[model samples]
Target chain A: MQGGVIALVAEAAGAEALGAARGLDGNAFVVTDLQIAYLALGRIGPVVTSARVLGTGPDGRAGAVVELRDAGAGDRLMTVVNVSGVPAAVLAGSTR
Target chain B: MTSDHPVDRRTHVSDYFRLERWELPSDGGDERPSSFGGRAPIDDHQRGAGGGLRTGGLLTNLDTLGGFTSGLAALPRWIVTTSLLATVSELDHVGPLRFRADVVRRGRSSVVTALDVVDEGAADRHVAAATMTCAILDPRAMVLDFARPFSLAMPPPQADPVRPEEFFCIEPGAGPVTRLRLADQLRNPWGILHGGAVAMLADEAACRAAAAHGADASGPNGLAAADAVLHYLRPVKVGPVEARCQVLGTRAGRTSVRVAIHDVGAEDRMVTLGSVTVLAV
Candidate 1:
């Protein structure tokens, strides 16, 4: 797999994970730095990813870790950690 | 922007950016060695079976295409890549692969270009994306200026270096060092070894080193690259460029590797440097 594609997936997963953690309905974060570790080849199907918030900065920047797995086989495909900038409103739980 | 005449093609906004296309052949035989040092026996398990274009192939194309786009943006001048980073989440090996690139940022002294490898059927879905940073250099400043030499810290050379034929089409060099004899197919439009090719060589070298370091103990498929950063220092115009890689470290299932590229005939003058990280998945 191309690293560029992996980065894009990681970026998307990061945003979703952050949004879910904050109980928001929409994503409003921008990725800054990303690190990914490919674990296995993803079979043809929907890729399942789970994200966890690692930490959050005072300036509304947060770090998260996400894991991507093959939906069909449930084999972990890759792990990604990234930092993103979030809107203050979303971080404060004021925006849905 | 100023125009000399009305209704002139040069004055059109579309004239600032140009689109180009290329076709790369697949079916290149796998020559990659099972591991470095040729100590491990080549087996089916070591050679995982799945045929498509290698990840390196896509990187090669991205480098060339991204560079081309940046050059077009440079216009009346030329630009050279300072660094390139590509992240691929998916793989597509089907033939007649098509992609498009656009100049995302045109600064006074630098140009940033982005490329997307789209699905042949669904044009909106991009399978892969890449970005390149190129430095716009003055034509008159193209002359080489030597910098003070410095020493590099590297591990001792391997006793039984892996052969080149087993990993790449390039000529075999000394132990732990792979060499690529410059050929027409390997050259970019500028008649030099393309940056993507350089990145491929570096990635191969780093991957081999990581594999040799026992990072593949996790499974038989070997370590999959997480990401890579390549910095082009000089152009490779001579034949038989050599690539040397060293395993920097392995921690938390992540292996860090560093690779250096040099011209064999030029007293091993460094031409490129790259760092790659892989997970022992």
Candidate 2:
């Protein structure tokens, strides 16, 4: 559960899908589009969420890569590479 | 640099005040029609506002969406707004909704994508999740000044329109209430996420179904949803769940889709069910 939380933090901090996620408005954390497949149930562990800005679209759609894994004392519960999110600035900027 | 042509046509906006200058047409008002060939059916069992998950934070500070620029530095702002603009709930009873996204496939003129959202730490529950594919927008074609005199139609989103993955497809192949989630986020203090949230999810799934219908059938005749009409079963408390989405078919250029968000544990039970009809433009 926290794995998803960590991933979201990266997104709010200006991280794209790779770096983080997009916000719905005001450049914070926007969940424009999303799809998640439940691989396994929530498990306690040091889930490591790392993101990197993959690329930016000419229209302001930036992509990022997010990798989540339970880095605690257990097996890798979930390995999801979500390719989603629209930059908050993309929408907020238009308001200018 | 600033909001000029070419450079301003599709570059990042450095200021918030400048973004608001792109006034949205007030004529259409907030009531966007749900039908093209026909109007979307308004359900009778729908739950009125004041319950369920809400859009929360983002609705209050929509300007934040403008600050972001797609990875492509030269894209226009409106394109970003329609194709990539996202929202989440944060800091309140339904506090802290976070969003994430990325592009999976890129076409010469469009792009395929996906994304996810979670509680910012409120109640410590991953309430909802979703995936989407938005196309790249061109600044040359769409102008804020030109859009100034527009109605409500914010130009059809220029998407890859092609399915990047079979999973992302929302085209329903079964019954009207397929792939409905059993559990969802139940933190809408502002009553923004309940019925409205249901409508949003249903619309999204229906849109996917519409796109698939358009691609598969190919033609001005293919059917897509003119609007997604949802009847709220109830404002059931969402206790962490994923709904199932099913695509129906395209009829008269209107693609109809159905989805039910229910409890993750009780897949058999239903929370909300509805269908969307997208017209093939």
| Highest lDDT scorer | 1
Model 2 interface CAPRI class: incorrect
In candidate 2, what are the lDDT values of residues B1-281, reduced to their tens digit? 11234322121211111111122222445332111110111111211121212221122112122212122322332222222222221111243334333333334544333433444444433332222223344545443343322222122222322211111222334333323232212123221123333444454445454454343445333332222333345444533333456666543333445656664454435665644434333
Q: Name the runs in model 2 displaced over 4 angstroms.
A: A1-29, A41-44, A52-55, A74-83, A93-96, B1-281
User: Individual DockQ of the candidates?
Assistant: 0.04, 0.03
Comparing only chain B with the true structure, the TM-scores of all models are 0.63, 0.31
Tens-digit lDDT track of model 1 for A4-94: 7767787888877666666653356655446444445665647777765644433454556566676766554443333343644534532
Full-model lDDT for every candidate: 0.54, 0.34
Per-chain TM-score of candidate 1, chain B: 0.63
lDDT of 2 by residue, A1-96 (tens): 754765454444334342233334424434332223223334777666555444433334444444455666355534343333444444454321
Which regions in candidate 1 have their CA more than 4 angstroms from the true location? A1-96, B1-52, B91-98, B119-126, B138-168, B172-176, B217-220, B223-226, B251-253, B279-281
